[model samples]
Target: MKWLLAMLLLGTCTTALAQEATARQPEPNTRVPQGVMRYAPSGFPDRIVASPAQDARTGFSVAWRTDTTVGAPLLEIVVAGDSPDMGDQRRITATSVALKTENGSAHHHRADVDGLQPDTLYAWRVQGDRTWSAWHHTRTAAKASAPLTLLYFGDTQNKNVSLTTRVVREAMRHAPDARLALYAGDLVSGGDGEDDNEWGEWFEANEVLPTSLVVAPAPGNHEYFEEFEDTPQERRVLGAHWPVTFALPGNGLAEAKRTTYWFDYQDVRVVVIDGTSALDLGTAKAQAAWLDQALASNPHRWSIVLTHQPFFSPREGRDNVPLRKHLLPVISKHKVDLVLQGHDHVYGRLKSPPPVFVVSVTGAKQYRLSDEARRTMRPVAEDTQLFQVLRFDGPRLRYEARTATGRLYDAFDLVDGGERGKQLVERDEDRIDERACTRAETLKGRTDRCWE
Candidate 1:
């Protein structure tokens, strides 16, 4: 019965989806940047991001941060309408969590809206004290599988305010219909509370991008901080802002919770693994067991996994051996459609029953390719920042890697053969040639060509 209800009504979401640019101030992207940034909590809310729930068909979530003075933050939402009376909205009090940061203490509020109609557009805003945020738009997933567009980005760890901002802007411009955007960790390099201002910069870089679509991020090691630095009893602690920043699905290992969770968006089952926990802490074996069961019970037609660390590391001599050892067998056996990752600031793609992509999308940081990466990862790149555009239509998935300037860098297609099995076929005849260290002589080396 649940499977039958999963049938969706959206044909091509890229066409029907609403862009946040409409009816807003004459700003270029979606929202204008506010001057005089404040890391400490203010009277109003900031750092607002929406996330797809465990079952996106009927529900979705949005999280925001505010000062402790704003008691009982509220979310106001209504089915999208052109009528000026859209103010007739439903209100839900938010759940708030308090924490002390390097700057000052603040409250992170999360509000989950359930029982919404699938594939419907809705305008929402968060109220803090007496102030309310300008309205933001979001759409729910279809009741069943249909044509969907997704955007994936690598690390946006450094210089988010100046460098990473443009990359994110280009991605939004190129794929305005993308309903979901996943970032493979290292979102903010300001580990723990040492520099919570990076969190403010990150949110500032994207503007309303988080509120416009689902910005589900996989926690990178940088998201963890040492509570007691320079001490013998020092141990790693998850960033206090992580849970407050995202209100993701809770169907994951209780021990890992938000960092390791899964969600079904449209026809795709998306799973996020905590490589930081798997490698840094010691949850590989436990995660492997959970992953096996998670993949085994997948009811969606296609499945993909996201993590900060790649199974095949792209950086020289930097490999996540434990993650590969414990989880590789299960992933290969299950034959997942795709594994999206970021950690090494390089781009590499491999072909197989399940293709893996280690990509970066920040101009702030770049790394050299590994010798093993050179031999194993064809259609590889170094010193290049990129974002991937994915379109899913029934059994076929179209994937494209676009550079920071919105130029096509790599392309491929994954066809689900149902009975025969999934096959990866190249579709990059027009894309620029492979980028690597060897091409320095012919491809202009460090001048224009990458692989530096």
Candidate 2:
């Protein structure tokens, strides 16, 4: 189960993790201490997560947490065949790190498994102190750009247990063979010190998805905080859990490291950015330069960029001008196909073509639309938790946005135009009316989620 996101591993998300620190007091936190302790790392491994290799065609990476008692945990992978058998399983060792957390001291292990055959089904598992997890499954990226399906999410920062879990489960049911599951950022609320139990909820919400698809994630502002609280040395730093939670490829600006990385699953290249660092920590210039370089060196037909902060906003007072200044120029220059983003906690997709910018939310949190969004985007929806399923076939990309209950809300197609970029072809046949806050809903004491 470690391989299947056995951590707080059950949930729903169709979003970009637009993790913004709202002025609202007391952020929504759904972590139950008992839940955290119930699955704490002991002899058994928890927080088991898998990330795609830099080149996913024939490789992948996995990470899991355990107690110190399991110093030399066992990892084995075998080509999925006739019956569950380890007779052909290949045993491998992992690099271990000791992580001290508020919950307790635990050991984290990472193993980058490569040299496997492409497009092959494989079963893997981890053995900790005294027990073993269920055999988890994963497939290597196809050797070439073939028909591919993927899932995208915004922030599930809050209400992962109550809301996001169902969203994730729904996505899996919707697209059983999705190769990659991309999270825009802010996977949890307390991406800081109080991060453990929150992550417990996240991992619990993400349950079996990790074992099957590439659990790709980017870091949102919430993923960082002043590690040293109430002290002179206090500074915004990655939470104690980020590094130990995921095994993302570190192929980006050294300053950003694992937080800002990318991977290629097939004919497409996904460039994930650390929007928090660019806007808050002054890594804008270098990060932008890197983006230009990443796209310039690309060998794929389409390039999609994923970031925690969006180039556009739906929340009235919120505008990420700084982020746009650094990131916009590069994305424009590259003619990227899709710029998927989160943070607005609302759904807004542009009516135009190439490099379509989409800001969506999958958690219970939803925001009102902004003046700018109304001016630039269409078919917008508010107060609706949504998920997106994207299908890439040769030169065409089908993008569909469905509500949490699986109702088609917005649908479109990006047709390849070669030098002209992708043409926006709307597919609203099954799309429903825009979902926004109603006066009746507001009168139900939901003023905070209205679109007045």
Candidate 3:
């Protein structure tokens, strides 16, 4: 009986070895195209953000990371049929330019997929020679006449991995059908590759939605890193990976490149500005001038502006006075419906004017609201992770601010255009029962502060 058992064990080991050998064997006409390593040659897959622009309904962009430097990695997209089953999928190929990071000097790959069906679902994978990633899925934007929902989040600069992930996941759970996501700014903790792990965590936390959700990001002060250099010209690097990671509308400030751009989704025209460039680098003239042109040329029924610094912040002395003076007139002139911003790490909505201005924070950190902030804004909250859900139907626009716990903190709507822009219709909804922090706690005693 012992002899028979030994023989059986030997046979089992032999079969396992044969299978392993077969799995390790390279495919014909390919280099090392066997085993799991063949699927991910570059181990560091990260910073995945997608954007839908140009012909938004039919086009999308994806940016991801790789372990080593390579020349222009290609992305393959497969449009899945209406059936959710895996057998009904068809694939197409596309390519994007490569970018190099400073830390570990990894290669970042970005690809823009266009000429797709409007409001269609697609699956995609990133690949290099002898290697390929798993297929991720995404849906295109709806047509102009169709009603759509979007998720909006403020700064995720601090505790991005821990706090921001919960808020983002909650937002997704609450609004699974949300078509697009708008990030006000400060998506990263710092630009100089500091807290690089935070970037990894942020990507990992949102991996479930990175490929599917259409993300639009504006630049913040934290996105800029000062490279070690003697001349002032070389010191500033405003978001090195932003342009490479997300395919956005390249039609903003002509000289600003990807920093400022605009794209139209259905009846809404969303404009993004690089407040960091305008404020720190003195590119305000160029951005402001181009903003005027972009706004003037737009023909959409609803217009929304996104930036990092709030023109009117709850942080007492932290108001963007120069930006307010320079840009508000243009926003007002163009009759923009919403102006979304961050950097205050608080939630504020000013409804006095035609263009409603909102500053909200969605990360772990919080700030105390000041008296000035309270005077100018309504439904302000501190020490809370908040996000906004926007629904657009014809001429009516509804917005809701909710906490991470799925509580509605603020709600409002806008109806029609023209002089009625200033007339905000507040809904009689239940405000989440939460305590308002005193001004002392909100400000943290820092009265004079600005993004350096």
Candidate 4:
């Protein structure tokens, strides 16, 4: 039935024949022939993704990829109703670009849908000539201080993406109505970060979730990588796929446009900073200036900053001193609500009030928590895959951190204090014991072990 549905959707003439023809062509972008990337006819609208609009309440953007045969870039959206019909819909043409990936070549299309009514349900789909994707549905951001929920993830760098997929799927199941999905970098395991097959795995793992939920991803150290062979480690450049895949708001300064950006959703503002550009390219001053400006021009009552590197290092030997020194004063001066971050594969949350820093992991990668983490950060956990669901209702913000199996490990609430400060109320939840690597395990040459 599924095969029949696909054939009917593609039409008889273009279905099997197109797949067979495109399969025979050589994929020049990759060092080796990659079977994971299905070229053209088979890869129609495979990498469909969406992001929160620069102005979240009234706008959103989407991007997708297809083979060369589908030359025209188009998107059609209809206000969802009781009836299912394509006639009463609005069609918007998009700007198209031909991208040559390491594994193959495909056409990428991006469209920013603006002037939308707030708190409305809409269905949209993309097309390449005669091939059309099934309609996907999404809701715009609400204008008022209605309750809003969002999912936050840590580094997802893994060769096998099933681990991260399981956590993400469980998180979505837990909070099906989450408006935005925020990732704190390292979406893939490829060292150079331009491996198309790995990106294909990532897209396959994510499925259609990004198509509806707005994704705001900050690039970690892994996102910038050297070329396949000749490029040295120090010459690591931004992955080509990062810019083309996500249609993020380009409100960043100079060279940090897409990687370092921010947007307002509902009653809150999220600022995404580029730690790699600041540390690697000597752009800390520029990024810091932009952060000050972004925080200064804020109209929302709640402000949160998202960056790949944490201000306080969870691991003792792995310190991001430069990042912390450059950005901490700005964040402290602004009194940001929460600082969401990744990079340190352990889960560490400070016991302090507003501007609480949290470092967690959603993938299978594990790292030992340092002594400072265990003593300073309350309820620290090691070797645990976790996800965070944050709820904002006017002046109060509630955060719940759960493991992959849906166990609530930590819970806290922040109440707005107006001119004073936000009050941090912690919750006591009974969970598993904090785990660490045994001394025997550490003796076997594994450095990332926990100590009792």
- TM-score of every model versus the real structure: 0.86, 0.88, 0.81, 0.87
lDDT of 3: 0.74
Give the alpha carbon lDDT tens digit for every residue of 1-452 in model 2.
67566433433121222223222233345746433564466878888888999899878989988998877577889988776554678988988889876678889998889898989888898878778777888888885558999999988888788789898888888898798999988888774445677787888888788877888888888888855778877667877778878888879888888688878889889999998888877898889998899999889988899998888777788888877888899999999999998887889987666789998888866678877778889889888888899999998999998888888988888888877767889887977888876644342355555521
lDDT score of residue 250 within candidate 3: 69
Per-candidate RMSD vs. true structure? 14.0, 10.0, 12.9, 11.2
Candidate 1 accuracy as TM-score: 0.86
Per-residue alpha-carbon lDDT of candidate 3 for residues 212-270, written as tens digits (9 for 90 to 100): 67888888887777766567566567656566656677677766787888888877888
| Residue runs of model 1 more than 4 Å from their true location after superposition | 1-37, 192-194, 227-234, 436-452
Error of 3 at 136 (Å): 2.4
Q: Candidate 2, which segments miss by more than 4 Å at Cα?
A: 1-28, 31-36, 191-193, 227-234, 439-452
Q: Give the candidates in order of lDDT, highest first.
A: 2, 1, 4, 3
Query: Quick one: how many clashes does candidate 4 have?
Result: 3
- Candidate lDDT values, in order: 0.80, 0.82, 0.74, 0.80
lDDT of predicted model 2: 0.82
> Where does candidate 4 stray beyond 4 Å?
1-43, 192-194, 227-233, 438-445, 449-452
Q: Tell me the tens digit of each residue's lDDT in model 4 across 63-130.
A: 88887666657888888877765457788887777777665677778888998988988898988667
Best of the candidates, TM-score: 2
